[model samples]
Target chain A: MRAGTLAPGKRIRPLLLVLAARDMGCNLEQRAVLDLACAVEMVHAASLILDDMPSMDNAQMRRGRPTVHREFGEDVAILAAIALLSRAFEVIAIAPGLAALQKSEAIAELSSAVGLQGLVQGQFQDLHEGAQNRSPDAIALTNELKTSVLFRATLQMAAIAADASPLMRQKLSYFAQELGQAFQLLDDLIDGCKHTGKDVHQDKGKSTLVQMLGVEGAERRLRDHLRSADAHLADACHRGVATRHYMHALFNQQLAMFS
Target chain B: MRAGTLAPGKRIRPLLLVLAARDMGCNLEQRAVLDLACAVEMVHAASLILDDMPSMDNAQMRRGRPTVHREFGEDVAILAAIALLSRAFEVIAIAPGLAALQKSEAIAELSSAVGLQGLVQGQFQDLHEGAQNRSPDAIALTNELKTSVLFRATLQMAAIAADASPLMRQKLSYFAQELGQAFQLLDDLIDGCKHTGKDVHQDKGKSTLVQMLGVEGAERRLRDHLRSADAHLADACHRGVATRHYMHALFNQQLAMFS
Candidate 1:
């Protein structure tokens, strides 16, 4: 679990969560937000471990090192993944200074993101549908399931922690959805690039938006998503400059590789 | 997830939870108790799926059918296990009539039972140490981790639901530990027996109490545990006749296989 979670990587999901919480005007102590952020990252780490298993993506490298299943045996890898997942919930359940109701809501949000309707469904679809001639809508839905669901959960959790109004939560949800789609598109665009420091050509045979739209068209859609995400952020939170700056910097860094 | 969870089985963990809750004078509506019981069963089902994976026990059969990974692909099976696990917490988090604090406590208990201090550590030790020469104490500790920890959590959750006194909770914990040990020992004794369903001889060549102490000695030890469990239960709850009867019937049925 330590090997998988403590590895070097950009914690983009946690950053998104923290920024969203701040943008939502969360007044909780730093520890509470950090705990929730860590929980989100742990969930991400657990998903990545499973994705790299021999039975899944079967990648050899992750974050520039051997995958968890490669470094440890498969049994250990599976157990570690579960341990991390369990720990993620445990952290939330015991997070100091948060109301029990808030914690329960957060757990509900995060668990759904990891369960049948979220990562599990997405991964299953990707494995079963990726190589098939999937329709554009089907591919986009899978992308949303794979990526946007967790992002939605992250922002929702932040909203819950912040006790934000339902309207604000709705706007943030839209923002997360657009941002998640853009992030995945960026990932698809850079699938085989070197500086990414992980497996290359992972989508080589997969039926992704990038496959159907071609590079230039895909980049156009990516920009559209970014624009929509920015609009939603602007409507949801006036003081979201940090979030806007971080997102643009991150996306530009990835897109610059194409240039 | 359905294939793994809805399969026919005794559902002993859930039964134990319900009975323990009743024994503790839990006054919640039956729905809340049932939901919690289902959550416990889901966790057990998820564990079985992973335990029967090719990398673990590699068993081909479970609950009189092909193991989950055999019936579903490994990827699906893995996802199903995770989904079940996530759903377990989700169920607890949303259980009606449970106070937010109680629900949080239950989630914490269950998650820890599944994490490093419980199933993960136990399985790791078993995989690494079961084949090696291990002391009786070492084997006992492993049994506590693998089996008793979840039982402990179940009873503790019941106590929480009932809002039972701390002293009563401690007694129930003792009862659960003893019962869990006896249950594992009985399972070890029944290895290679056909009427038990599932794959037999799962402990073959492994260093177990059954191997070290032989059949009669192990059976005697099992009896000792049952007796201790009974004593603890009697001390903890005066209105526990139903729990006592169910436990006796279950254990006697398993022990009768020897006759």
Candidate 2:
């Protein structure tokens, strides 16, 4: 996939995760934390690769450059995507100092986010018959599968690594859900604006938030999701001064984007 | 991919691991064993998907059926392959009553095997500029990267799940190495024969065994590799009656094919 396409998106999820890990006392210098960061980024990268493939979005350009399929050919693009995903797992698995079992759980979590219950299924839902014209609920469903799960998994893995309590993890999961929705909404807007000549509003035919609620309603729901995301950061805020700072900065950045 | 193409290709590695697990006293039920078997098969399926992509072998047929890319478009094929891989992880990750972490570890192992150090790197080597008409050792380097690591990881996961001793796990790894070589050799023979008129000996040119030794020498090497596979299994053999029976049958079946 074109690095340029990925470059267009703010790497908000990974940055938050790295910050969260730091707040939870994970050593940035540790290979595991570093590996985790790379793993999350690879997931982000893989998503773009798939998104740009001829079937999914049929996108010609991304990040102001030709998509992977366009540049490398479909065969190389697909293998390259697979290669990135596999390497993400390898990097984490081979990291030093983490117990073998911890490494395993991390791998499992990542896989779950990408697999049937997650990205693939989400993509399938969009691709399935009658899905092209999405209802609001259907669009929400796609957003959850295609985007939110990875955001959720990212925090879950970092929190698990930091040995956070179950409650903390739950809070983080909620935050991820909201954050993911916000990100998806942003994607819809960008796709709508930039892909005017293409099938930008094809989601209107599928089960998408845009189809169900109209453009204005979808934007409103996005705000609500962002609010929840900010609210869920309360626990993190209470935990430590550094964490509060991170939460504030993250929220501020998101707020600016929405504005 | 056609379901028929994925029909039980000996399932040697997974069966060996489950048997090893039993021998090590893990005592999993038939259902659990079956699940692991499926997981292993999924890995095999995923490998086929990658192998058939335009960049790699660009093989149109697999196991006498159309490849995934042929059946579905390249994009769907890629997603389906990923779906299979993710499902395999799900099977292992959520195997009933197993520790979550253990499941995670198995997933990590499989992913690593498929990723950079394993299949991906192997594919990379095959696709590299230096790959064409390389020396035997260079070809071996690609084969080991592409095929052998996965072979080793399969046994290792089985051993880990079975709680086998570290020493025994080492033995299984050795067995897997030889088995992998034998398996690849068989692949070479099949491809060399079947694809002779289709294109250049595409996969064969990617082999070290063939380049260094020539086709006849490579044939001898394959036979030697199988012999070594038998020998390694023999070294690991012990009191497990079922395992012994299965291993004997497996070796005979594969050995017969080559003969």
Tens-place lDDT per residue, model 1, A58-140, is: 99899989999988899999999999999999999999868999999999999999998999999999998899999988988
In candidate 1, position A90 carries an lDDT of 97
**Best of the candidates, lDDT:** 1
Model 1 chain B is weakest, by summed lDDT over 10 consecutive residues, at B23-32
Question: Compared with the real two-chain complex, what DockQ does model 1 have?
Answer: 0.91
Residue B91 in model 1: shift from native, Å? 0.8
Q: What lDDT tens digits, residue by residue, belong to model 1 across residues B48-130?
A: 99999989899989988899899888998899999999999999898887899998999999999999999989999998899
Which regions of candidate 1 fall more than 4 Å away from where they truly are?
A27-29
> What DockQ results for candidate 2?
0.46
- Classify candidate 1 by CAPRI docking class: high
Please provide, for model 2 over A76-164, each residue's C-alpha lDDT reduced to its tens digit, 9 standing for 90 to 100: 67667877877777677667756766676777788899987888877777676444554566677778898889988898878867877
Tens digit of lDDT per residue, candidate 2, span B25-104?
66677455556667877877887777777766777666555667777776677777887876777677667745555565
Report every candidate's CA lDDT.
0.90, 0.69
Q: Pick the candidate with the highest DockQ.
A: 1
